[model samples]
Target: MRLVVAITGASGAIYGVRILQMLSALGVESHLVTSRHAMLTLTTETDWTPEGLRSLATHVHPVGDVGSVIASGSFQHDGMIIAPCSVKTLSGVANCYADNLVTRAADVTLKEGRRLVLVFRETPLHLGHLRLLTQAAEMGATVFPPVPAFYHEPKVIDDLVDQTAGRVLDQFGLDAAVARWEGMRPLRERQDQQPDHQAALGEPVNG
Candidate 1:
């Protein structure tokens, strides 16, 4: 399978990084593009250098290269994912602003009737943010928020990152085997074993 992965200037660069890693492991071809500001976030949020990030993708495109093959609807990709999608990029896609390769690729994906997943990273959203997200969704794009799942019993940061990345891959019909809810037993077990603690933490114990 082939996919386009874009990283923006959002706070969580790791989501983009993890998505690339998951795609690589699944033997999926990834066309990577990163906004210029994404470099700053990458350095601030991860130890990986720009070179290292490019190494994860099957092909790397310059963010300014709107003429690249992936920018066209005929490029034939399974979908496009904008992990850690910033509001700027979201607005661009929502408003049909294709000034860059990332947004252009996304626009192409939508026009081609292929999946376009946006892993929006902002929080405490205002009304404008909600409207942009709604607009993107109405345009046949999936706006995925990378919210952590405590039910997975994540012990480290990687666990949380991997779970979210895995779920994003799920949109492409790729399975990364990241922790997922198998049944109610796990939650029931936790509830039965730690009712007081669950109540104290304001966690639901029963359905």
Candidate 2:
């Protein structure tokens, strides 16, 4: 499957990086576009270089290249994802502002009636943020915030990143090795066994 991926100026640059990594592993064709601020954020937040991040995708387009193939609606692809989508980018998409390649591609995606996923990374949003998000959703965009799930028992930062990336791929019907929740039965059983094991070890158990 072919997809257009955009990395914007958001704090969690790793989300976009991991999405590219997973897409590459799945042998998916990815067209990547990274904003200038996104590159800086990547450098500040992670060790990945701009060159390394671009290498993961099948094609890389400049953020200002509005004439790129993915910017047009005729350039058919499965979908588009703006990982770590900044509020600025979100506003552009919501307002149908095609000033750049990222927003242009997103507009084309919506116009083509294809999936448009926006991984909005901001938190503690105000009313304006919510309104913009609601507007985008009303325009057939999926506003997916990278909220980490603890039920999967993430052991490290990478685990959390991978889980969120995998879930994002899931939106496209692509499955990754993310842990799925079966039910509460297993967790309850494990919790019950935990106390016994602690008692056997003569460890102090909290009531």
Candidate 3:
């Protein structure tokens, strides 16, 4: 499956990186595009240089190069994911403003009735942010936020990122083994393995 992955200027650059890593491991063809501001985030948030990030994908498209293959609807792909999608990029997609390759590809994805998942990374949203998100959802885009799942009992930050990435991939029907939530346990089952169960499930055992 070919997947277009876009990393915007969001706070959590790791989401995009983890998505690329999982895609590569799953043998999926990843076409990556990083915004100019995304590059800045990479330097500030991660050790990855632009080239290092590019190396993770099967194809890398420049943000300004709107003539790229993914920019057109004819370019067949399974889906597109804008990991760590910034509010600016989210607005562009919400409004169908294809001023750059990222938004153009996203617009094409929506027009073609393909899955377009936007993993928006923002906090303390105002009314404008909520409206834009609703607009994007109304246009058949999945507005996914990279919220951490505490139920997964993550031991490290990578675990949280992986769980979020895995869940996001679930929207595309791709299983990355990142779902950390186990089902609710029966009374006997819970009591039989209370300590181990709590540790494994990231839940607190009461008495």
Prediction-by-prediction clash tally: 0, 0, 0
Estimate the TM-score for candidate 1: 0.91
Q: What TM-score does each of the candidates earn?
A: 0.91, 0.92, 0.89
Local error of candidate 1 at 160, Å? 0.6
Ranking by lDDT: 1, 2, 3
Cα lDDT of model 2 by residue, 1-207, tens digit: 999999999999999999999998999999999987999999999999999999999999999888899988889899999999999999999999989999999999999999999999898999999999999999999989999988777789999999999999999999878877766667677786454766788887664
In terms of lDDT, the poorest run of 10 residues in model 3 is 190-199
Q: Per-residue alpha-carbon lDDT of model 1 for 43-117, expressed as tens digits? A: 998899999999999999999999999989888889999998999999999999999999999999999999999
Consecutive 10-residue window with the lowest summed lDDT within model 2: 190-199
Give lDDT: candidate 3, residue 13.
92
* lDDT (C-alpha) at residue 199 in model 1: 62
Preferred candidate (lDDT higher): 1 or 2: 1
- The candidate maximizing TM-score is 2
Indicate the TM-score of model 3.
Answer: 0.89
- Give every collision pair in model 2: none
